[model samples]
Target: MSYTDDERIRAKRRALYILAQRDHSKKELYDKLIKNYPPDLCEMVVGLMCEHDLINEEKYTEKLYRAYINKGWGKSKIRFELRRKGLPDSLISQQEEEYDTEDFIDEIMHLVDKKYASKLDFSDYKSVQRVTAALARRGFAYDDIKLALSRIKDGDYDEYDE
Candidate 1:
């Protein structure tokens, strides 16, 4: 399909409108803009946005990674999300390495404690099962979940419990 000059101009304006609210990767903007205009026009608009620094994959990746971490998401989940956004594998790998493993574990434990530690009886099998499923659904690896559960089982975090 092809777009006329007026359609192309409107596409660029629409792209700018999308960016004014939040940042988007070139691919994401292209995907959205293409719905309104032809692919070629969408590509041109994406290129223009790139030239003007309106779309940046690197900045978007970093900000998204930090935001996901703040939301207590695990590396595996965050990596999958960034990959789906069309980010380079190497960039995602670099961001993964930047996170401290120890801190990641602590974050998982904190999430567990906040959600399940208060009312659930750790001694009960059903409670443990529920907590385990919750951790897995949150994208924590089995080993990390096991370690966090073991710590609770051993009362290692007793001092922090209220």
Candidate 2:
């Protein structure tokens, strides 16, 4: 059966509403729309939105990258999230360069210090292993983790345990 013009307009309006909720990659928005509308109609609506500058994959990718970085996610996790959202590899690469590596290292260190402060014991191998594993899971490299751990003062650990 064919859809009426009013129905097509309604579908396009709904698609725009969804886009307004957040930035969406072209493929992601299209997939969402196709679930409720005809594939061809979804494509048409997407094209119109692009023409109006309402749907932009580059802008969407950049926003997603910024949001993820602000949440203190590392490059690997950020890349994975962007890929899952259908962002191009080149765009992801370009956006990743905008993240400050020093800031990321500081954030990782802050998180590690908070979580392992009370558990630290310089003489205990198991404690060091646990702290290192925690930092690694937070997306920090081994060397960075080691360096941060080295900077944790004995007094800080003692105070935390108290």
Per-residue CA lDDT of model 1 for 62-151, tens digit only, reads 999999988888878888888888888888888888886766777777887777776557768888888778777777777888887788
* Cα RMSDs, all models: 2.2, 4.2
TM-score of each: 0.87, 0.77
How much is the lDDT of residue 110 in candidate 1? 84
Count clashing residue pairs per candidate. 0, 0
lDDT of 2 by residue, 35-105 (tens): 88888888888888888888788888888887876676667778888898888899998886876665666
Evaluated with lDDT, which candidate comes out highest?
1
**Predictions in order: lDDT:** 0.82, 0.76
Estimate the lDDT of model 2.
Answer: 0.76
Candidate 1 weakest ten by summed lDDT: 114-123
